[model samples]
Target: MKRLSLLLAGALLLQLQASEPSVFGAGNLDSDSPYGLTESEKKIVENRQNLKNTKRKSQENSAQLQSLRERIDGLQTIIEGLAEKTQENKLKVTELTSGEDIGAQRDAKIAALEEAVRADEANIASLKSLLESMATQVDAINANYVSKDEFNALVGEINAFKRDLGKTLKSVSAPAAGASLESKSSKELAAEAKASYNKLYFKDAIPMYEELIRRNYKPAYAHFMIGEMWHYRKEWSKALSYFKESAARSSKTSFMPTLMLHSAECMMHTGDSANAKKFLRSLIAKYPASGEAAEAERLLNTL
Candidate 1:
């Protein structure tokens, strides 16, 4: 169908060219010729005008098509550049991913070290139980050497003290009937308890600290201070319990260096020099720059 249209247009063009006015004629494009035009001549004139318009439009369309092709070529160059950049980024990502195995190996090593620390902690627990057993054995053996009359008197005194001691721990934990403990904040109560403790007024401090322990307000520190009081009195057997309680509550503490120092000293007094030496050495290694560590080092030599 398109080929047929082109053929008919070519024929019209040829006829228009043949019927055109002569160049020598005194005729202008806008004006009629001197002679009047016939019907067929007028038709040819109109066809010639139409052909000129069609040719002008075709030339404008060709220029637009050339401009479009140049734009497409520029866009293609940009696409190629973006593709190269994407490939380079993929290589950089691969380099980062390749180092993950080294991280995995390091993590495995750290896990092994944590496991060893846990094992040592378990051994320490066993050693503590052994110390308690030794103290019991020593008490039983000493009883055998005493005269019957002396043994009877000693047993009566020990029984009376045991009953009182058990009651003292429980009874002191309650706030006095008229005390304003509820009106104060836990921190305020702790400060008051610390002041009493510093003055060596254990009778006053023990109850306040015990109240804090009941409230779960700095329980570890409260236990540590109570243990410190007992340690000052050279009551190693009693102090060890509170020290263990403090350690169980929290191992990480500001007083841990001092706690460890005193714990080793407690062990030495309680006839467990071997365990005392081990604990002092551990404390020295753990806190090498602290004053408590210096004390632990001196204590370890004696053990």
Candidate 2:
């Protein structure tokens, strides 16, 4: 029984050795060999799992590369926009610098104009001062040449001479102390009229002469005196009327020739040329030997 057990143990040991795994060849199972097929099947399952992991990793890398390309395009657009903004800023800075230069030139021109105006004002002020000084000197010279007191004294002497000449023209005598002019005789009234006329008081003499005429005195002489007074007063129309009346009243008197010449002169002054010529002709024919006749002849030739 012991020997039979030893032969069975040896057979079992040989079978165990043949079933052990081998590494030198591809794992295949064979009935001739004692190894099992389980190791080869497990290797096939692991190869399938590795193939699935490699395909998933390739897909993830493709998605990451597409996203990186999109980010690069966005960065390029931002850089272009920044470049355009930088160019615009450069142009604005140039315009500001040019404006500053023009403003400086304008300021200088304004300052120069203000200086010129101030100089003109100073010159004008000097001219005005010089003109005032010249006017003062001229006034001083005029005052020295003709003083106010000397001019007034000269005027007074001339007035006195005129008064004396007027008084001399009247040759009337003085009136009696007890007699009033209104109650006096015709001769006294005539004398009073003559005295007033000699003093060049025509306004006073005219009324006294009129009174003599109312009393029927020597009215021709009174008319002559009134005519002379009217001539001196430049009343040519009034003087002509009185002269005509005196000549008509006293045709043979010594004053007729002179009266006729005076009438002609008054006619000429009054713009009555036809009447003046008639009077001048009458004077030349009636008083040929008188001095007034020669004067009348000369005046007629002018007419």
Candidate 3:
């Protein structure tokens, strides 16, 4: 029984030794960086080189991921503020000593605010899931390594403040019905729209801009122009909605500084001071040399 046990132990030891993790790979190589290598050793060396390359790439990915995390943190902060405001709405509801109509209006407003908060939270969750998938895209979801294409795409999505003015937007929509705009070339419509806008005939300019948006001719600028008209009208909600669409498309336009300023004002009027401050600060940081940045700095102090 003792001799049988000894033989079993020797076999177990050999099996354990065979399963050890190393690049040397079933070889008699003395060290990892040996002087001369066989074909198998050469293969191992190549693998090591590839791993070194992956590590370098991993470092770069880590930097991008860090930036992503900071942005996520900022978003989470905004969400928290929204949540706090929603709670305050409940208190306001309880303290409503006003008429039923007033109470109903307050309730409706609170409900809208709550719904917007829910949508924002859902968006944040989706973004987090996308990042997780991005991390897992390569070979068993290795956190350390990400493909360059995936990384670049994720960066583009997360880095909202990034400007790419030269990028042509290809987002075409069904044309809004307009005989004159429909007949006119895109260039002609753009020229006419700008002239009307400059003349402060914003009401006249709007349909032309909407036509441009539908035609996919500078849709971002079109959206911004429509938002600007709304801003002039002091219709904050409608302006904000279009501003968001404009930013979603192309945030790199020459008019972007004004868009940021107006967006910040819209948020402020809507009782979203935290987000308004964020927008103002981002504008100041990104367009520091611009006149809009000068305005943003003054606005930031007031915030």
Candidate 4:
């Protein structure tokens, strides 16, 4: 019975030693037993663990790489949009520059057109003035051929020139309100003198004419008309004095020959016979075909 109990104890110890090799490494087991576990089982377990670790690491790296790629794509999209916007701005600037050039050209053309128009207006005005002057000369020449028609035409041209000159004078003159009272009065007297002469009332014309002469307002016609009035009045000496004054005042007036004839007559009537003959001879020499010349010849024959 003792031997059996010892055997059972020994058997239990052997079982404990075999299980210890699995709990600890082969070094803790009996040195005589070289293998700790089956080689194929160890290799299969290590390969499985290595495969699991490799799969976990691959998953983590793939997630990180996906995030970086998404960021790079987003940056690329932003850069592309910036490039497109810059191109659009460049086009707009180009269009604005082109528009400015067009505007400058248009302004230059407008200024040139305005200058051309003004030059044409001045040229047209000069041409019209030349035409009117030529027509006046032609009408004067035609007067000898077609008396009444040509005379009327000439008068019409003279009236037109007077009207144009009056308008020009008004434009050139100082403002009427600023004119002196004396100037205004002289103009009125001259107008009245002209009206009286136009009515053939030479007596009524005299006082106004004298007033204009006193004012020194274009006194040539005033002196000539006064001399004519005195001659008609048969005041020989007075007529001669006024006629001499008229002749001295104006050389080109229609009154010159008439005044000379009257002076000669006055000299003859006043008994200055030698002086009258000399004056008559001068009149005939100066005005060969004039009415004064005829009168002088008649008077000389009588002498």
Provide TM-scores for the models. 0.41, 0.40, 0.41, 0.38
Candidate 2: clashing pairs of residues: none
lDDT of 1 by residue, 4-107 (tens): 99999999988997798654553343465533556666677788877767545543433333343233223323333333444444444455455565576656
**Model 1 regions lying over 4 Å from their true place:** 1-183
**What's the residue-level lDDT of 219 in candidate 1?**
93
lDDT per residue (tens digit) for residues 205-300 in model 2: 787887777676888977887887676565789999999888778888888887888888899999998999999999889889986797799789
Q: Every model's Cα RMSD, please?
A: 44.8, 68.2, 21.3, 58.2
Most accurate candidate by lDDT: 3
2 or 4, greater by TM-score: 2
- For each candidate, the alpha-carbon lDDT, in order, equals 0.63, 0.60, 0.67, 0.59
For candidate 1, which ten residues in a row score worst on lDDT? 161-170
Per residue, candidate 4 scores C-alpha lDDT tens digits across 1-303 of 999999999999999987665545543223444346567655755676787675555444434333433332233233333434444444554555557556766666555555554554454455446535544554444443323442343345334433443233222222333233345577787786665453333544677787778878878778877776666556778878877777778878765777777787888888888988888898889889885787689789998
Off by over 4 Å in 3: 1-177
As for TM-score, the candidate ahead, 1 or 2, is 1
Q: Judge candidate 2 against the unseen true structure and give its global Cα lDDT, from 0 to 1.
A: 0.60
User: What order do candidates take by lDDT, descending?
Assistant: 3, 1, 2, 4
